[model samples]
Target: MAIPRLRPLLLVAVLLLRAFASLPTQAAARGGLDPSPGIADRKHGSSSRSLLQDQPEITEEMVRGYMSNFELESAIQDFGRRCANISRTYSIGKSVNGSPLWAIEISDKPGQREAEPAFKFIGNVHGDEPVGREVLMQLAYWLCDNYLKDPLAALIVENTHLHILPSMNPDGFALRRRGNANNVDLNRDFPDQFFPNNDDIKHRQPETRAIMNWIKQEHFTASASLHGGALVANYPWDGSRDTRKQYYGCPDDKTFRYMASLYSQSHYNMSLSKEFEGGITNGALWYPIYGGMQDWNYIHGGCFELTLEISDVKWPKASELLVIWKQNKMSMLNLVASLVKTGVHGRIFAADTGRPIPGSLMVKGIDSKINASGSFGDYHRILAPGQSYEVVASMEGYRPKRTRVMLGREATNLDFILDPDGAVRRTKPLRNDCGCSCNDNSNTGKPFLLREAYLWLYLLALFFLLALYLLFRRRMALRLAAHRHPPPKRPVAV
Candidate 1:
């Protein structure tokens, strides 16, 4: 009996050691193991050999149809020339390997600042996920080819400024790896809300720094980053305070849910997914991830962002890209259209000066605050429709204004005109140039003036009587003169 028990205990210890050995040491440093279903935990030191052995080798025939980094850049430049009237191409920054991170801006006014809301679509955040970059180029070509012919395309181009960054990790894509040339996960390099590990900007990767700076430069109202290995529209808060795997919603939980559903319900079959209900999920619920770009966007950039897992396979055949694009076309269009179709957009102004004021906008019960554009004082606040909200606009030197609005299915325009604090005292009194005493000051008359008022009244009465007598005498004299003058006028007529 003792020998059997010892043998069982030894076998259990051996199994435990093997299990521990399988987990890489870096897993603990990246905020414990990721429990997200269906997603390979490549960030946590998943073995490259095992990953490579699992997937079929990518042959030359496999990549023949796909655009390389060089081809993608050339295609973007060609698109810029082809659709120069409505679109322009520019590079935000270069990757660590000196690959230009190109961005195609599509709008009626490409580089000009307008009062309209801006939306950005970032693709290929991970190098191994090359589907996004291809799909993005297709999206650009589709919009360019069907602007006036398609009503939805016309609406997007006319109403909103759309920016597309095809591949954010060109170096990683070139190296045929998940991370950049530095081997750092771009998605996990953002400043985490709950963790201090990635808070230092100096240690951030170059791509992460470029994105952060780009957000600061452009006031994007909403954005989305594309990824692969699953089909779900993921919204924030991506990480939790305790780092536990649970459902964590951000401040704009309802609006984000509506946004996610808009993308999923419009998709061909994303809503039919058995894994994700409606092909949408809260990031933390799926699995808590620290230093994610989605949560950081909401917390720091004030941009409502979604991390979209667009494909089930990270590297699908190049020929299948068009089918994938077709499946996601409506979803992408609807997601961008939601910005114009379902938000409160307006400008704040000073009442006295009638000039725009860069004030802060806040909802009564909501914890978040969206600031107006510095130049135009314009703001686009995304909220769930069919509800009433107490919207407040505030400025430092101006009196805050609040309005009760009942938002319906359509977008609402609510502009606030704030009055300067203590404006009433500075107001000028109206002038009475007619010389009439409209205001009565008799109650506050001087003490001596009150006593002398009767004497002055009597003197005024005597003078008035004398003047009446004089007027009567003069009228009697004038009547006699008129009687004499009338007879002469009759003779002149004859």
Candidate 2:
């Protein structure tokens, strides 16, 4: 019995050794760790030849003209000093290696919160693709130099709050690789709606976490990331369910196409692409990817983001960088201007109290919803120009409002002052799917009962303060009485 068992064990060991011997070195070591899907698969030689493939070895001469990490930071600080009136420099967070992630915000009122729509341009999402970082610096300086003289630049600067994050992955840039210092791709590090690979927040990269926090804090209306290795404007639905490479679109698919077309059409020759029709392609359609920043922005950040591949070469000769900027200049300007030039923008308020309310907005027939800013009750909805749309505004405890508008080439202004729920006053207030606190009465479905109001909030705060004051005064009077009028019978016990 012991000899028979030994024979079977020897046979199993032989098969295991053969299997391990036949595996590719990279694949064997990886062991399905990072799929490194999407962009890495495009035209590269090698996890991520996907985004920035076909580039020569990253030699010092290759990156000679490109700004070093120190030079990039100096340029940022210089921009803040030179354009001090219209720009402010700040750090969002740090990279894994403690590289300061610097950002420049440019507007008529920099560093101040306003009701204007905010648009951000994130460059160098892939450290190896440094074209974006340089181009973004160009964009910032252009707006600074031409704020009043150029009409398009002026429109963007005055009507919108523009933010520029020159490089999102500095460590990756320094390493001359696609991923960060930890070798994780920043683009694929975001949380994916289709998969749970990045659901563990504790394991997210520092750069990715910084971006997520910034999105929630600033609440940008629209944004775009720059890339290379191809020349096309890529929109959302980056990855499809079942991991299939096909066209899967988000609810705002039409709006996204229109926005992408603006960038492509404005480019010097991007719209004339032979590969991408009209120089624009849906992300999933072009190449399906998981945990892409574009899709995550739309789903979680309420930001309409586009992944723009502006160059055919990843790390082109630094001499070619200016031409790249000049080619994409109009496209960038047009996209930012579109926020104020064409779209639906306004504030929401409670009808009775006349204060801003956190009302949610949705377009008829579109599945996605836009949440108005809690600070100003402000929302911006981008749509195709020269089209008709049915827009609806609703909040818990408030009567919903809907309207039809024929949107023109210029941006439209629409404000909704919703009345509190009154139809069913017998029910309780509850939170709705839109993250709004709604008071719902069960008696025949009534609306409006004051769940999210600045006026009610102020009043409740005042009432609590008054009650606190009275309680404190009453206690003081009792203390004084006890000190002045002591009981006489207690002395005998002592």
**On residues 32-125, what C-alpha lDDT tens digit does candidate 2 reach at each position?**
2344555335432232324544556799998899999999999999999999999899999999999999999998899987777899999999
Regions of model 2 farther than 4 Å from truth? 1-55, 423-494
* CA lDDT scores, all candidates in order: 0.77, 0.80
For model 2, the local distance difference test gives 0.80
Give candidate 1's whole-model lDDT: 0.77
Report the Cα lDDT for residue 408, model 1: 75
Specify the poorest-scoring 10-residue window by lDDT in model 1: 22-31
Cα lDDT for residue 486, model 2? 90
Candidate 1 global Cα RMSD: 25.9
Alpha-carbon shift of residue 160 in model 1 (angstroms) = 0.6
